[model samples]
Target: MDLRGKYGLLIDDIAEMRTTVRIQLADSGLEKCDAARNIKEAIERLSQRRYDLIVCDYNLGQGADGQQLLELVRRRQLLPLSSAFLMITGETGYEQVSTAAEYAPDDYLIKPFTSELLRSRLERILEKKEALRPLYQVLTDKVDRAKALAICDILLAAKGRYVLDILRHKGQLLLESKRNDEALALYQGVLDQRATPWAEVGKARALAATGNEEEARQHLQRALDAYPNYLAAYDSLALLLEKTDKTAAQEVVEKALKVAPSTQRQRRLGGLALENKDYPRAESAFRRATEKDRTGFFKSHDDYAGLAKSCAEQGKIDDAFAAVKDMGNHFGRSSDLLARQAAVESLVHVKAGNPLAAKAALARALALNDDQALDPTTALEIATACFATGDAETAKGIIQSVAEDHNENETVIQLAQGVFLAAGHGEEGAVFLEATRKRMIKLNNDAVAMAKAGDLDHAIAMLTEAADRLTNNCQVSVNAALAILMDVQRNGAAPEKFSRAQTYILQARRANPEHRQLADLAKFYRKLAPPGTPIIEET
Candidate 1:
């Protein structure tokens, strides 16, 4: 296969490896080749031009390894779908290279292999890519699920030795289309004949999609036990635990990290630590991820934010400031990031007996947003800043807004209540919360009645109108909308109507915290909709 027209990026820290690969590619007729000695240069090159192939070394000193680079490229949508990624890993042990699956490179090549082996692997990947060009084009263009399915059907009809591969692709397309039942049936059919890890994992994913976490956990756990180094199983299991059991989730993450210490795994572990409020562990994990994958997916402004938060919580003011400063330098002053930095800066100022500067930082953060409302997390940080600076009134106001927006969120409500109690306003806070709840109930009751009276159009109109009117009752409005959407779904309306209902459901969830019934309803409606249909936006 002549590769004269194909562009390639060769990334390796080892000069000899780079030279050898470059020569091999050139010899194989790939004339348009570029080489980078490390990830930083490779990323810079990638930013400047698109390449048909990326050949990266697994080990890159002081920067992103091959796995991390691949993940970053994929997650950020930096690489074209047709781009071929080949990981050249020196590690022979399955455990050592298991994390590579999490990134899902186009192919992998064990180092110390003959040129013939490399050529064969590259040819195989190219052949597969060529075979799936139509599918890839649809996926890349974000075409409708129905269109993608049609493409898959056409490909599958051409019987070949790669029929199983076609089945796998079709299964994935079905899942993406939200046809969990069909995907699950296909996966089950495959599993009935053989113990395929991919098929089992797909089944577990379908289970999760249908809101059967417990069953999904069991399936994934079984897969993990059967194939200990099956990295996909670990990823799915971690996702399940993340929603239900944080401790168990941490354990799964730790296990995956031990099997293959990729930057992505470390980043996930850091996220879990942050959620658990284990500041030290969070800091360690985030720092390690950033260091190991300097140019990888985990290296972003958020890592610095996590580090700063951990440092601030630990009272390491200077370190926190340094981290924040570095973050600002890397990614110009983002309002959210600056809000967090301001809060931590306020804490440091209060500790230093400089109240004025603390107040100024808060004002600047608020100003950056044109005085618009902050998100729950930013509001919490601002409240913390106010409390530290003895501005109880400001802190209370921010807390009130957060509490209103997240009334159904037990965690946020509890945190707000705790802050009030700590400040000796427990009784007052309780009274305020009670009044807020009453107002929310009344608003929801009114909306529900309108919806139940065969006035769906009017009810939807009311709900949309009420969104602004019930600004102080965010959760109430969201729940009301969700209730109406659920009713629409149960009625089995037109496809367009169902899509609109799904949109409202998503909007409601995004506006409020997690609600069990609402989540279930949203998932149900999603399953009901056909694959690839555009979800209708609710007016």
Candidate 2:
């Protein structure tokens, strides 16, 4: 290898580690290399320049961990196809953390590795990168599947050291091309030779793609049995359990967290707790996650926000305010956090018998998001705050919004209706809900007409474009998008269209909780999608 004209990034929390990796990369022919002590600096560098290689330490001391950084890059498609991501991890709990197969890197090097081992890993990655250069180029350029597959075929035909590598790439291409049977066969062929966890997981995903949940579970179990620390298999099993058994799903998440308690896993567990209305557990999980990493894939202002909401639900005012204070300190001057804090403050003031302060806090929160209405959960909070202060009119308005946007979200609708009943307006809220449901139905029907006319693209485009315009039509937009996606599938097209539709549907569901149809649509799309598409959590 020539020692010139290569760019690289080295990210580590320890000064010694950064210095060591930087010197090693320079020695290995990297003429240009930048080192960052933590994820924030790494992201800053990533935003400013392009690098051919990223050597990241798995345990960054602050901000995002190495795995979260890798996930963000891969999820956002930030890294170039030609780029090689080589994760460096110490032996401590390595097996537990090593289960991150879903966020696959080009290669990994264990810590305390000699220069020789580092060189060997890098050389192997470079060799594979070179071998698949043509396919990589086509993929990076967003060329059609046929061109990429053609290139993969050529490489697969003549492989020696890269034989397993070529098969993996070809399997990826087949999946991308929606040739599930061929991809399944290829993966099975690999599994037959060696019971590799990656190949087994691939087969399980293929089984899921073909709507064989029982078989998928069996394959996933096999992978888990062979490699008990395999995190990807646990993730797949969790997803499979989500629709069928909530308790089992929660246990699956807990098991994954026990193996390697990353921020992502904790956040998922927190979400499950929230769904079960286990406010204390949800609060603990969210708080733990926020305290662990200040900035990462799980570094959501929402985590703190959720914790505060959970505390308020359990009447833990002091704890709620403390969480709010943490948010203010962690994310200085964030509008999202500030708005959430104001909402919490309003609740606190009302509970403390300060009607004036509660009113002012509510106004400030509404002002912060440019007066945009809150979600059903937050609306319920606001309603409680307003009722505590004897502002029945404001409480009615907040509850009405919840009733209207969340007619399908039974949990929320019931909560809001309870607020109205407590405020002596149960009949009024019911009447309001009926009228809103009628309006939602009409809007949904109109969107469905466009889809039925075979204008699914236009229908989706129009619905999304008008999303802002239809301020109260959250359920309608989501249902319409799902309908159009199903129609597009019936007509048969590329998965991208369905992917786009799914994105909109997910957004709508986030805005309006418990849209069952969205879940059903997601399950349908998952079956139609090629194997190994990243599994999205059911909201």
Candidate 3:
């Protein structure tokens, strides 16, 4: 527990606990300690400096809990691999969340513990981290997976105190690398030693990946029966159930939400409820999710849209309008958000029998789309509003574009079918969707053929041309940019093409700001041409 010259962060909501922890860390030889009362503050402090240790409480008021904060930090690459994180909790339910988390702290200390116990736990965690330093380095950095696995194997050969942990890490890497059979075997072996909850869940994951759904369900149920509050088991069980039974999946999520009502789980529950046409439940879930999300670092426009739609469908025009207002207040006036918000507002007005007001709202939505075409999801909202306002032609056009761009996405196709059915055009919608799918398939197939035939230039040209024709289709723009970047990478760095790639990327970003691939691509472009701004290395 010698922390001399090693900075640390102590996070806890209770002022007394924070003081106690700070004193304990200072007594343990830490140079100094920074403190945060919540996830937002913790993120700000961590952003400023890399700490040697992070002591975080499992619960931090009504906002994001310690588990969620850790997940976000790890996802954003805020904490370094060498920083030891110790999560403190009084609730036994935390074990399930920690077990299922993709990123875990170095160790956990239960609350109401003696300082001796805390020091002992920290010392043990530090020792284990020291032993696993090499494996962690390879795991965290840009290294070959095979090399990292080999390093794990070497460390495991010593039969050390961290043997089980090493096995777990190796199994996870194996699963991530698509070596499901080996991962399953390794998880089963861990169960033989002792049936830990994490091992059971891992085995179930591997089983599900291998298409052994029945066995996976059984294993997941077993884990839940053993630990009823295991959030991870609930999540896996719900996902597994969704493949066959939506009602069962919804129930599982409902059960999990009662135990740990995270914004993400609540939003998912709302989505399921919406799909089931349970307007009241969907409205409640989405409202709670929207409120929770507003307190976080990022806000989700989809949640606000969902809330407004559910409220309008339930004939709660005032609540629906309020939801739309909330979106405008929180997210400013981004065209994409504005389009969706205005569409939802129109739905409320139409439901309230105010045709004039509904028309005005729909007109605003249409103007937004005219300025910058809407993405598929936002377009769906606008189409719904148009149908409500008795503007079938405009709705049809929007739905046609949606189906054309999203033919491969079953969810979007289903959503379009629902919208068209609501508008009294089910049969025509089906025909339009089918025709659009066929055309898009042909377009995609032709470009892919050129790509496969080694006509990189032609393939890039074709995709870029399609992108111009489909400015709002994020997938097309992203794919076109990625194709060019890949070709350049394959031919060694081509600096001349970087600007072209960036243009496509920026366009795609404008169309779908939340697209996941944008982050990695931005990082790639930055490496190719380092920015003039100061660089902050990702942990």
Best by TM-score: 3
1-539 per-residue lDDT for model 1 (tens digits): 54668889999998988889888877677788899887678878888988888888888777556676777777666776778888888756424554445457777777677777777777777777778888878766543567878887888788756667768777887887789999999899999999988898889999889888799999999898898888888888998887678778988999988777876677778868866778888889878865665544356655776677677667777877787677666555657768867776776676556789888987766565445455566666777677777888878777766776666676677667656754567798788777766766676677778777776666677676655533444455455446555565657546566555555565565554334455465466566667665553333
- Show where candidate 1 strays beyond 4 Å: 92-102, 315-318, 347-360, 371-539
RMSD in angstroms between candidate 3 and the native structure over all alpha carbons: 5.5
Worst 10 residues of 3 by lDDT: 530-539
Report RMSD (Å) for each prediction in the order shown: 8.2, 10.0, 5.5
- Largest lDDT belongs to which candidate? 3
TM-score of 3: 0.79
> If scored against the real structure, what TM-score would every candidate get?
0.70, 0.68, 0.79
lDDT tens readout by residue for model 3, 405-468: 6655678888888788667788988888888878876776777777778888888998999787
* Candidate 1: 10-residue stretch with minimal lDDT: 93-102
Q: How accurate locally, in lDDT, is each candidate? A: 0.72, 0.72, 0.80
Q: Candidate 3 has which clashing residue pairs, if any?
A: none
Kindly report which residue stretches of model 3 are placed more than 4 angstroms away from their true locations once superposed. 91-100, 138-154, 157-159, 292-294, 370-380, 383-445, 448-460, 467-539
Between prediction 2 and prediction 3, the one with superior TM-score is 3
